[model samples]
Target: MQVILCEDIDKIGVAGETKSVSEGFARNFLLPKGLAYPATPGNLKKWESEKHLREIKLVKNLESARTLAAQLESVALSVPARAGREGQLFGSITTAAVAEALLGKGFSVDRKTIDISAPIKTLGAHEVTIRLHSQVEARLKVEVVSS
Candidate 1:
């Protein structure tokens, strides 16, 4: 039986793909689970249009991420913390703090998206990586100064 996959099936086919399966599998499993639809002429036409729209949306999203990454590169952020005479900070800078600082500067970023490999514990410029998207990463400079 010929069917159109509505969702990806591991080891089988991806969404928006047409595949041929055994009659029992198509009728009993795929149809009942809504993983696929019968590859009729009408369904095929609808899937093609939808797949084209999906591709356009993906391209737009990638463009948006790239622009954000470029903008972030020019951004300079600071965090104030109390430090000793030797310049070791009393407290540490965290991902939440970085997000808050970004929010203060008109950029709303999630804390989880700020990838801090280790807690910042010194009084100097630190490198922070912001994973804006799977394909985009922005290196942010966080300068820690004496409060």
Candidate 2:
């Protein structure tokens, strides 16, 4: 069966993509969950138009993300955490903490967008990558110091 994806599906495809899948899967899973619609002629046309608009929006968002990235590059964020004598924190600093630090620096970064692979265990300076958009990424210097 042919279906148009209404949202991004991991291991499948992005929104507005038309793809073929098993009829049972399309009807039972994707359609019921509102993740996709049957790729009829009307729906396909609608999807095409929606895809064009989404592309334009994505371009504008990417430009804004680039500007934000530039601003983030110039600022260093400090995170205060409880640490031992060896400068190892009792609990690691997570992306949520980084996002909070960014907020303190006047950047409204979403925690989901701040890509910290693992929590910072040792207290020191670390570079964290913030994914502002699919194409725009920025490095933020995070200084973890004792409180």
Candidate 3:
């Protein structure tokens, strides 16, 4: 069956894309979920007209992501925590903590987008990765100080 996707589906296709799939799958999952519609001639023409708008929106999003990435690169975050004499933190720093710190700095970032490779149990400086977009990433400098 031929379908035009209204939303991006993993392992399938993106929005405004036309694809072929098994009839049963399209009718049962995609159609019922409102993720896609039958690829009729009228729908195809409508998609062709709206394609330019989608492209423009994508370009704008990419530009904003790049700008955010640049700003994030220049930011240095300090997180104060209770620590022992040996520089080990009483508790580990979490992604929620990092997100809160970023929010205090006037940047609204989701905690899920922040990636820390290991548990921050020691007090020092560490690099964290923030995924702003699929094509843009920024390394943040986080300094952990004893409170």
Q: Which candidate is the best by lDDT?
A: 3
Candidate 1 has a TM-score of 0.66
**lDDT score of residue 80 within candidate 3:** 85
Error of 3 at 96 (Å): 0.9
| Model 3 agreement with the true structure over 67-98: per-residue lDDT tens digits | 99999889989988999999999989999999
Tens-digit lDDT track for model 1 on 1-147?
999998767678877889999999999999999999999999999988798787787679778988988887789899888999999988799999899988888888889889887889998899999987656889999999999
Compute the lDDT for candidate 1: 0.88
> Best TM-score goes to which candidate?
2
Total clashing pairs in model 1: 0
- Candidate 1, run of 10 with poorest lDDT: 6-15
Q: Give the 10-residue window scoring lowest on summed lDDT in candidate 2.
A: 7-16
lDDT to native, each model? 0.88, 0.88, 0.91
Clashes of each: 0, 0, 0
